[model samples]
Target: MLDLLLAAEEGAHAEPTAFFLEPYQWVSVAMVVLIAVFIWKKVPGMITGGLDSKIAAIRAQLDEAKALRAEAEALRNEYQAKIAGAEQDAQAMMDNARREADAILVKAEADSSAMVERRKKMAEDKIAAAEREAIADVRATAVMAATKASRKLIAEKHDAGADKALADEVIAGL
Candidate 1:
């Protein structure tokens, strides 16, 4: 380190650093100047202005995104509240439905029982009418049989004299 320092000090006493930048060395500086000139001449002010506007637009877009995020968060909270209320309403509706179903079931059972009783009464009436008809038919048949037997005993188709004598005896006995 000390040797490099001593060598640099000795070289400084030889000549100036700017003077060492001779004409050939100045070519590199001229190229740097040409690049600066190209930037100044070729690049339009409108392009730079448009770039600045684009940067501003990007910043504005970021601000808008932040606002949209806040809005989305608010909407999420509102919808969540609505969902909770709807859930409560749904539970109430389910309970109401169950109660209504139970009432309907009880009513249906009562109506069915009444209908069954009416049907039983109708059947009993029919059975009683059939029994009465059967009894009447049996009485008519008994009377017919008794009348046929009595007619057979009182008749004498071929013996008119005998029938007349029996009829006189029956009348005298009476």
Candidate 2:
């Protein structure tokens, strides 16, 4: 060792050696051995298989989520259709009620008019009956007065000769 160091100090060039190889060459050899050991143990295959399983699990979860979303959308559409139908039904009911109210009002008006006409006719009939009764009473009073006047005139003019004359005139006329 001392001789080798002296030779190096004398400007004599010598290649560095370890285990019959240079240091850089030994590092390359160590790397090759480490790669060979990894291959023997199948570490690469284990890593790839684990990654493939994780990818399959994630895809299954995504499919489940998509199915759930589709189901929820269908339910929402069904409820919306039912709400629209209910609104239409309510509108129809309101229209029917309005028509019924109009019909009832028209009937009531007709009935009231008819009743008024009947009451007017009854009042006219009562007035006509009263006028006829008054005429009959006037005729009865005039007939009684005429009978009294004729009786007085006959008594004043009457004698035995006029009585015989009146009997002969009545016989001749018959």
Candidate 3:
């Protein structure tokens, strides 16, 4: 080993005797270096272009989602306003209904009072009619008794029509 090292150091070695002295190995290593350099330059641009396309696609999707969300919020606000307006209208309708019901009740009460008063007046009229009927009956009885007494007196007197007329004329002259 020492002798070989000395000979190697004397610069008398024209060729290397190691196992890795094949000429094809250098060409293969150079080819590998050239391919690596080519890949390093070209592959980065392809990768960046692919990543930029992906970022653009994602941004487009995000914009679409934002627009849809804004539309949904606007629709929700419109529905809320409609619901509020409907509730106000319903309250007004209920208030009007209550007022109408109160008016109907008042009118019914007034009509009932009027009917009661009319019934009382009719009862008083019936009583007055009954009193008039009794007075007429009494007068008819008095007229019938007077007619019977006058017929009895005329029969007891036994006077003829001519004699009665003569007596009535003399009494008138006196």
Candidate 4:
């Protein structure tokens, strides 16, 4: 086995001896020079710095997005509070309106009742006045009828003999 390995190593060295004279060897040397030039110019470092700057920009964008989201959430909360306050104010206004309506209704009812009472009182006063006028007219008619009847009776019953006797009696008394 040791002799076989030695024979393989000798064959490898022999192949390389002719490789130096081949076109492939020139290509290999050119590749090595190119690699050395790239290292001297620090191309790998520039690529790494560019990639790091991109990562930093992406991180800054993410931070800005988070800040904007927080501000939007705060604004939403403030609007919700304002909406709640507006609802409360509206409810209070409705309550005040209801109370005012009730008060107005009560006042209107009282005014209507007072007006009805006044109308009733005026009607009663008119009726009393009419009754008093009727009574006065009846009394005046009775007095006039009695006066006429008495004058008729005196005219029929009185005579000149009675009148002379009444005059002589009145003279004796005097």
Question: Rank by TM-score, descending?
Answer: 2, 1, 4, 3
RMSD of each: 26.9, 35.4, 33.5, 33.4
**What is each predicted model's overall lDDT from 0 to 1?**
0.89, 0.93, 0.89, 0.91
- lDDT tens per residue, model 1, 68-141: 99999999999999999999999999999999999999999989989999999999999999999999999999
The residue-by-residue lDDT of candidate 2 on 1-174, one tens digit each, is 776799889999777788779889999999999999889999899999999999999999999999999999999999999999999999999999999999999999989999899989998999999899889889988988999888998888898899999999999999
- Per model, how many backbone clashes are there? 0, 0, 0, 0
lDDT of 3 by residue, 54-88 (tens): 99999999999999999999999999999999999
> How good is model 2 by TM-score?
0.42
Worst 10 residues of 3 by lDDT: 13-22
Ranking by lDDT: 2, 4, 3, 1
Output the worst ten-in-a-row residue range by lDDT, candidate 4: 12-21
Model 4's TM-score against the true structure? 0.40
Error of 4 at 23 (Å): 3.8
lDDT of residue 164 for candidate 4: 94
RMSD of 2: 35.4
Task: List where candidate 2 sits over 4 angstroms from the true fold.
Answer: 1-7, 10-16, 89-174
